[model samples]
Target: MSHRAALGTLAIGGNPLVSRRVLSSVGEWGGARVGARGAGLSTSMASAEELRLVARIATGDEAALRQLYARYGSLVYSIAVRVTGDRCAAEDVAQQVFIRVWERPAGFDPERGSLRTWLATLAHSRAVDHVRREQACHRREQRQLPGAPSDVEEVATSSAVAERVGRAVDALPDDQRVAVLLAYYDARTYREVAAELDIPEGTAKSRLRLGLRRIARCLEQEGLGAWT
Candidate 1:
């Protein structure tokens, strides 16, 4: 079996999969991921026995969660710090990850992707939500944030590289395009966009719907839209 495959299989099966050499390697990788989460794990190594702890996490074990935190807290913390550009926020997001893992252990679906991928996706989603919150607050500070503003910009079919994205976005109707632009670019709250655009909030939301649907249609044309 391939190296990662071995790691995955052993990890899921709760076996003594760590060879001496692999033990050293996993120790190093574990440390690195932990260090990414935060600043101070003087030695980032996991002993050979750590894999069982991780597998327990895979099985909804509480001690497994603790082991995961011990092994990877720094790593997740680091990613959160980088994304939020604030130590406190990063810590908050990282803490939330552990809470989420504990509360809904069943969310981890190996068929969807590896645990690492799922963790990272969680980090990114939290970061994005935080950014949106910040942007909304900033918009409130600035008077120009609109609800249904036209956030659509000129398609860079001006270059072939962005052609696909440009075409997809362009396929949206005027209302949806306007709604999307207003909310996404102007950073307007949906309510603001609705009021400013003289449409009901639901109508404003519908515009976004129409526009996004068109983008999905275009993305389906490329077979990559399903990644969402």
Candidate 2:
């Protein structure tokens, strides 16, 4: 297996080149299974095996990469989803973690920590970066919208304001809450929210509008509506 083949297997849906690569490479490589064996081994033995796997991956062994993913993909993905609160974003973060491993296996220094700890750290940092990027994008979008808050970060970071807003959003109907969250927190456009919820675009817009209005009314009733 070449480096291209290793990278191809790690691909989910990010780069065009990566997305175009097929899963057939897994079959071609005979799908070597190492994860289960490693799981039953002693700590030191498991670490040794993981080091060997990374060494093989550095040499373009797709089977080793697949084995590594099999061993730790769930851990990485769970951390991502817990932080990002979005399954789709979590999937992207998980793929990125594996792709980084494939491209730079040497980055995993066994001397510094166990492979599991290292992977967990990578997953956490990547998830945090994703959340920050989404927040920044959401702030920018809010700035551009008419009557939208000019400093969304200010309101969000304020404990009192955030608590109020959280309660308001929680009180929304299920459909409206989902739409509002997708648009506001997820940084998705109305059209994107519509597609995600499998609703018409007009319905998506209407839900968001109603949700925001209700939240505003709630905030105003509590004398915190001037947050914007």
Candidate 3:
């Protein structure tokens, strides 16, 4: 089937056989759930209708999935486009977001936040990953060029510093570590991190502050404070 036809299947409903076929067709594009915890809105923030829709989706009600897509498709696509700066990439990210929901509807925990927030977070995360991969590919291509600059000593020093930083980050508490990584490694702003992790902006800032302070202390203890 053409790519558009394949994507069209994402919204198809009412028949178990057709649903399974569509799922199988889209299975080649793997997906992962966003399970990070954030100090944001609580279960009370999610509406009863949204919770019921997710429950129905979990039971393989493709019509419920269609309802979900119709409700949030534009939002997801818009977020993806903003992050990736490519309409085509945005479309791909949006499709993957819905596919993930279809495959693992149970992953949506109303206790964490609203379904709309969850979908937005998932879309942003996927878009960031897409952009990161594209940049990595571009970097690889640059490195392959004949006259690409190479500095052995600088490379070694950078590698050592990166290793130490990685170790320091890993030593952080789970929640702080996620916040720190999202803010630093993922190049997300404090607001973006809050949105992506479903945390309030203040909470996101606090996590970054605490995480960075801890990492700085760690580096100081190791005589690497200058690097921090």
- Top candidate, metric lDDT: 2
Candidate 2 per-residue lDDT over residues 146-217, each given as its tens digit = 112323323443245457767787688888887876665454678977987799999999999999899989
lDDT of 1 by residue, 1-228 (tens): 333433343343222232212332434233445334442222222223334454565566655665566655655665566556566666556655655665555676655644554676787667557657877678534544433223235432332323665767666766777777666544455787799788999988878777877876875677543322
Q: What does each candidate score in C-alpha RMSD?
A: 12.9, 15.6, 15.6
lDDT of 3 at 197: 72
On the 0 to 100 scale, the lDDT of residue 63 in model 3 is 78
Worst 10 residues of 1 by lDDT: 39-48
Rank all candidate structures by their lDDT, best first, as comma-separated numbers. 2, 3, 1
Better of 2 and 3 by TM-score: 3
**Candidate 3: tens digits of C-alpha lDDT, residues 1-228:** 332454566545434354455444433222211221121122223468788998888788877776666566655776677566567777677777877788777788866666876898899888889877887687533212111112111233223444565677768887787777665434467897788778899999999999989988886787654322
Candidates in order, TM-scores: namely: 0.42, 0.47, 0.48
Window of ten residues with lowest summed lDDT in model 2: 144-153
Query: Which stretches in model 1 have alpha-carbon errors above 4 Å?
Result: 1-105, 108-140, 143-163, 184-189
Model 3 poorest ten-residue lDDT run: 144-153
